[model samples]
Target: MSLQFHNQLTHRVDTFTPQIEGKVSLYTCGPTVYNYLHVGNWTAYIYWDTLIRVLQANGLRVERVMNITDVGHLVSDADEGEDKLEKGARREGKTAWDIASFYTDDFIKGMARLHLLTPQHIIKATSYITEQLELVRTLQKKGFTYQIDDGIYFDTSKFPSYGHFAGLDLDAQKAGARVEFNPQKKNPVDFALWKFTPQGETRDMEWETPIDLLEPIVADGLEYEQANKKMGFPGWHLECSAMAMTLLGKTLDIHTGGIDHIPVHHTNEIAQSEAATGVTFAHYWLHNNHLKVNGTKISKSLGNGYTLNGLGEKGYSPLDFRLFVLQRHYRSEGNFTFENLESAKNRLHNWRNSAALRHQTHDRLRDDDEKSTDDESVSLYASSQALIEAISNDLDTPAACAIIDEAFRKIDGINLEDIHQHALTSFIETVDNLLGLALFDTSKDISDDIKRLIIERERAREKKDWQAADRLRDQIEKSGVTVRDTAHGSIWEYVA
Candidate 1:
């Protein structure tokens, strides 16, 4: 199967082949772990989930690593603000570590509800301080790092291709409206790899660098710092560069984040990573556009960001939001409206109810006599093959899902013969086996039992006897699998 997805770097859809055969490694920027993830941000998660599902559908082994920035992320992208965790601590009246841990747990719980497969590894910035410092040391040794009074900075000019990933020109980022130009910086685009704290402040998470160890820094907040005192942690951009390089290598098969992250955040990562390793940062850079409300981008400071909890307060499930996300291509910004959600929820409910009906019909066919298990198996095998074909094609889930509806309708109009009915049972079994979206209790042995019936139907169909196949197909549909007849054979699958 060939999968074609849009690559932001190339600005076009390209064929996807893994960097290595049968294996792909992906690194996505994870939440900053400072607050509940706003839904706009959660689109990145869902977009990646769909991609991962498609990868699995194509039979590739995927290894994914998403980082947790519990520490080292400053409130401002320019490295001019307080550490975000510390800022959150002040807001919540807790320790910095407490804030980080609290939000990290919250993010994990949200992923559980969203049905996202957990990343193979979840690394945290705080857990890898030594590794981060080592990266700083490497860059410094390689002449890619320059130091200001507060902390070390990565020289973006050291690598000329710094801002291209974000569709940004180098000079534009240096002078962009959102950027802050520091006088101490050698270049306007240089970003901190480390930061010095104002003198005398009690930093709950401060660490001593080689410079700090060498100087007897005075502890006075009003005195202000030209050197490290109580300043805590690395800058956000540098943390990603260091962590991503450490865990997934300097280059990755894919790098994913939101459109918001493109400019300063991901741009800096690309700059620092490539400068540090002198290699490409990522082969494919994918970014999902934002979700908007009434044509404005949804955000928290504007009092417009809604979480899954906030949406549910009005009696909507997170699944409703998930379905809403599915309605649009990931590249396009989707508008969120209560009216839109209502329509989607109605359609979702209709699909499930209709699919379930189709499956119930597949139940009756297993009782066929002379239902040689072989006939049942063949019928099922043929049906599932077709269903799998629909899903594996660029994750055309809507098409694959629609096929279920069509199959149910077709099976509803059929009567049973041994072979035809058996063939129908087999198709039902096939759809269930491949998609894992059937409405049955998968933990129960019902799937196995259904597969056995399908084999009998397949054998019946092979004999060129329509009566037994049709009978078994009807029986299987009665069992809750929808069956359809084709010129080639009979097929069946779960209704919902």
Candidate 2:
């Protein structure tokens, strides 16, 4: 089956065909780098990672771009609150620059721990200020932007397709305006492209506005003029549009983000991007559903947010969390609990053990010159085909995982002598590439001390010295290694 994705733009599962043949331009919204990324934040990355793997598995060269929003993400979607980075800085008693640097590193480390592939281009919003300003200038010249007391705002009324992606009711929104109803705004739905710095207040991160871009405005029967040299920052939605277009191009094959961005953030991106360039912004739009905990949204305000280190403190590896995420489809809402996480942990452990046993059996039996019979080859081919079919169908990860479970059961039933080493190796590598699980890793070099201890423990076991064997086992475990006594011999692995 060919790969398909549920494009949020069309609200349909469409077959994916890149704009350029043999190459796919993909972009995913990265973290704001204001604080440590919680599990909820990680879920979006996992979904995008799976998408990238699926695309590459289909033999399409992918040029993926993810942005690190170091600045310009306001606390509220209305773009009326403090910058998230600046808020974080105030909360942590650090400079905004320090906060961004620290959190960006932390986010990258968490991604590495979860085995997420780094994108081809990871651009920071602060690094692309020139591009963002240029984009704002383009919108102003195109007569799609208006200036207010706060900053430059996009005139959503001018863009006929405003809120088309989200199905927003412009008249209804104006009637039932709940918050951030700026009276100076020509329309309540209009959003800021750049925000002016507050009077008599200095900001650590602000850029001087271009003198020639100011336009006159009339408010409350009085003529007002925009500050030509005002210091301000870009808006949250502006950064994504600028960075994505700067790196990927005017149009992208796929644009991905959390479902929460569907309403205002992504809608504004479409309005401004299409308004500036008289073409479609992206071919496909994909969003992952929210990750909840204890029946509530995982947020810092709710005190339900969790980080990777928090999981480790509770005795769960990052891959265990990854497994938990994959057990459910990305488009479905997943509720996380310790019980569910434990189940995923146990599943991962069993799968890893089975894979190790298969490797050991393959090493013990097949000779270098031996080849598999027709039956073995057929079994391997069937298992591989099942996995491919499962993953290719809209990234049905839960189905793919079930196929893995079935493959392991089949492996357990087959005799080691009948399995072909080359075929088994190829199958295992393909599975790893598709799943992003380090299942076939056996590259750890055991130290001489641990090896000698294992040997002594084996001798003690053979001599019926249970007490000495138990003591040696404890010592080996204290050295951060786990030992399992099998019928063939004892196997040791590092404690993750």
Candidate 3:
């Protein structure tokens, strides 16, 4: 079966046929290193993670790249807001670079805890300064850029398809009628390529450009006194365009980000990239819906979102939240609440306990000499085969989740020795490889001592020592291993 996805570019939901056979190249806009990543940011990543897992499970080799926007991202998509990194610096009392370094490490650690597979390539915008300048030069030479009081601006009016992805009327875009219209822009939709550092201002993070220090030339719908030669910064949109060109070449297979990116950030990327390359920028465009809480967005400024450290301190395992995210599709917005998270946790614990039960049943078979595989092994094998079918069908994750849940519930019904072995092994290996659930990792394997305690707990239950068994389970859990009780046996997993 072939993979399928809803392509925003064509406005059609179609099968995901890659440009190259058996290999998929994808680029997701990663979080800007402004502060610790909030749960909202994580939902996007988790969505992408599921997509990658589903693709890999369908036997498609994926080459994924996620960009780290350490610089050139503004608090406002209108290109008139404060730099997010600079804001982080002000909040942390450190340099922008330091903040980027600090939080990037934190983000990586969070993903590790969640068992999210890292991208094949991580491109940082700050590191691509030379590349950014060259791309701007390319646009300049191509007659796509014009000098404005604010620095170089990409003349969105020049591109007939300026609002191509945005599905906005070109006339409405040019009329200064949109939100946050700057009176000084020649066209309301024109966006900054490079910002000339404001004159006479000592910016801690200014770069000297090779452009001439000249007097201001043009004015706009509304303007005041400002020179184009003053040192500023690179505008947000140009950074992604330049970085995407450098890493994925002039064209990309797919470009992904939050739905919020569709109107401005991604719109400008298409303008600049296609203007320079004279071709379509990306074949498919995928956007993840927001992870909203209480019908509003989660942002650091609002103090409404949770970071990994914050969630971890509250005793929520990172993967539990990751599993929570998988309950919905990438294009679907997921609700956030303590109730939902608790429900997801229970589901994960129950699944683990079922696996443990299967393992114990296998052990009993080994001892009985009648020779049969456990219920889990059989159920997993059946589920693994269905996993591919679900994933290939536009990554039907919710369906796959249901199938997995059913397998967990029906493990007891599977009893054939040879059949059970084949099914269980197949299920654990294939679905694990696809979902990135870390079910069979050597490092994640439970220690023997904890396993022994878990088995003892099981035996205690068998002996009808209910209180003692519960106490033993608690003790084992307090030792940093989580215990899950199943019909077949008790199982434990190490917590980080």
- List model 1 lDDT by residue over 214-295, tens digit each: 2345656545354333344677787777777777777788888888788788888877777778888888877887899767
lDDT of 3 by residue, 1-496 (tens): 7667888788888877778888877888888887888888888887778788877767778888888888778777667777888888998899888998998888888778877889988878777777777778888887778776557788887888888688978675456466545667668778888877665665556675545423344766434334233566677788888777777777778788889999888889899989999988888888888888766778658777888778778778787788788888777887887788888877776665444443433333544534444444545666788887886676677787898888766664344332354555456566566666655552244567877887788889889999989898788878777765545344455443
On lDDT, who's better, 1 or 3? Answer: 3
Instruction: Give the Cα lDDT of each candidate.
Output: 0.69, 0.84, 0.74
Give the worst 10-residue stretch by lDDT in candidate 3.
Answer: 412-421
Q: After superposition, which runs of candidate 2 have C-alpha atoms over 4 Å from their true positions?
A: 178-180, 216-227, 363-377, 442-496
lDDT of 3 at 397: 73
- Model 3 Cα displacement at 113 (Å)? 1.8
Clashing pairs in 2: none
User: What value does the lDDT take at residue 123 in candidate 2?
Assistant: 85
Better of 2 and 3 by TM-score: 2
- The per-prediction tally of clashing pairs is 67, 0, 10
lDDT of 1 at 468: 89
lDDT order of candidates, top first:
2, 3, 1
Tens-digit lDDT track for model 2 on 243-325? Answer: 99988889999999988999989999999899888899999999999999988988769888988999999999899999899
Best by lDDT: 2
